[model samples]
Target: MYHTWMRFFTPGPAHHRLGLVCLGVGLQHGTLPTVGPRTLDHHVAVVVSTGRGWFRTPDGRRTAVTAPALLWLTPGVPHHYGPDPDTGWDEAFVDFTGPTADTYTELGYIEPHRPVVALSDAGAARATVGRIVRAARRGNPLLEVETSAAVHELLVTLRRARADTAPDGEQVLQALARDACKPLTVADHATRHGMTPAELRTAVRRGAGCSPKDYLLGIRLGHAKELLAATELPVAAVARRVGYDDPAYFSRLFTRRVGMAPVRFREQQAHTVPGGWSDQVPDPDDPPIIGRTPTG
Candidate 1:
């Protein structure tokens, strides 16, 4: 008494090397039959968009599943679930696996412990799955690559839609990014936000998946790379711009993290624009070249 549309794929080794591959995707509704208390080799993200159900782990603990909710069926984990017999439920699922899945799990994007996650909204996630569905079209040449990319987007969208996420943590991340180049210590930044240093670390770790110091360093070094590659600014000036008062320390830190000296990175990444380096970036809305027509 259920309607289901699903497609499974066997991606080539090259596609698997892309860090994530789509194993399958499906959309289902109505009073679907119960899923087994079986184990899987890969992972599946079962997004319940409507109605209700219950999920059971290997330990036989059953948790209520209400829309919009997400269920993570990780590798080697036994899972069992079914819709409420009377009401049924609408569900969309994407199965994926690759080396990067482990990294994503470590970063908290894929929660193995929290099997069933309540989501604030499933629209975005459903839309991403829709993209995968469209890519699943018969005779589509880009099916593997396109669907694989959508799986990455789906993971990010689901993480953002988690119901337990706090707005304050996001606000703190935004504030930290805005003041990333202010030369403030973690303690200083925490004080400005009316939070203790430990609290700041917790907030950043929850929000950005890293410590406050590491988050700030990531922002600072990213900007430094842009300046080094796009501008003719001296290394010292670039360091200062990114909040490193001591140029030598900045270079050392940059090398340690970036795996090469800044100068060497610049030499490898420097690009020459058609009109040469300009301090002002052109507005997207502005006409293509002052007097030239854009070509398709």
Candidate 2:
């Protein structure tokens, strides 16, 4: 016999614009019966946290499903799976779909190609599903939005937990981020990491879903944006700080990518302080003193 708890939702069309909406979530354990060899129109992420099972492909190949694994049931994909009759398995699943689901698939976060992915750990993903389970309470006003957001988090958590992701690729990504403002070419970065340019490209694409050049540019541009918004630094100085020595080229690139000239973006994003402007950033650990009278 199997134990199961599940909730399904039909969020309004407006909720679909949130980029990802949760259609359902479930938790189950014990000797669950077999599921269909039928096709689904949406995606479901079935996370098995314990025990073992087997999955049958449309081609009729049966693959073992071990604990701490993810089974991706994608649109139009036929799936058949069940826990072992003797041992059973513990499982949590989230069904989700939206335009962003396509984007995520392209980014390698949702792997339809590799349906049965072994996970290094399922704890974090299970915790995220637990949040969805709690939010599934009937009559909750924020149900749609809360569960939708949690679905996005669950995708990222699952991606990170995949046992196939190379630790070296993760290190390469971290190194690239650390030196994003170093004004180095992709080849130079590759050399620094003791990898050939092609190897670096492969690593970045696998780890970040982008080429090394694009990844570095994204980091540089992000830092430029923060500087533009938070500091009064001149455009040329900002350019130099983000690895572009030529302010004109920087302005053109920023305009093309951000849809605004740097000066215009700064003007639009300038922040005003409650009192006279101060450059000091507040410590996040300190609690805010709310409703306090202002001192002269």
Candidate 3:
């Protein structure tokens, strides 16, 4: 036997005011919804909390949607997925749509084509979905605003989960942590790790969903930010601390990636936020941009 409940949000003009709209939220046990090959007009994420299932796409691809995994049905993308009849499954899911969806896709927060992803932090994923479910159930006046924030958190959680599970996930991350203050090329990075540049490229891309160059730039810029905010270091000194020897080139790169010159960033932060550091600190052991958004 199985039990289920779902809350479908009315897509009124009120919902569209937020960046993301929660179209529907659901929880089920011992059963899963039927998803035959078809396209949808909005994005839906069917996440399994327990048990297991399979997902099929339009081009005849199949994926095992195991426990703590997600089957993303993106808008206009043909897909199908459901639980195993014998074992069944426990699952929670949310359907959402907004401009942020496309932004997430572009940022690799959501893989529109890749349907199934095994989450590294199952507990966290489940917790986030639970929050979404609770918010939906509340049906408060701030429904759209609160649900949209929850959806953002869910997307970030999903991104971290997938990246943390990728092959060679920690190698490049560790290198960046240790060497963000040193000058190194992608080839040098690969060679030090006993991998070809191509292999390193793929692994880093799989783990972080960015090219090696972009990843390293993110690392350097993140480090540069801390120095700009906390230290009285000169612009050239700040650049050098983050591995750049040429201050002019470093300033240009920083301006491009961070949307402000190093000196300007420092002045702004110092003027406004007292000590000027954000409360959410980036974890030294985690990937770049963990706690901060890249302006670029």
Task: Estimate every model's Cα lDDT from 0 to 1.
Answer: 0.93, 0.92, 0.79
TM-score of each: 0.89, 0.90, 0.82
lDDT of 3 at 242: 88
lDDT of 3 by residue, 104-211 (tens): 887778887678877765678778888877777564777777778888998888777763464456766777567757788888888888989899887777777778
Predicted structure 3: lDDT? 0.79
Alpha carbon lDDT of residue 133, candidate 1?
98
Q: Which candidate order results from sorting by TM-score in descending order?
A: 2, 1, 3
Cα lDDT tens digits, model 2, 145-203, are 99999999999999899998988889999999999999899999999999999999888
When 1 and 3 are scored with lDDT, the better candidate is 1
> For model 2, what is the C-alpha lDDT against the true structure?
0.92
Candidate 1 residue-wise lDDT, 221-267, digit = tens:
99899888887789999999999999999999999999999999999
Pick the winner on TM-score between candidates 2 and 3.
Answer: 2
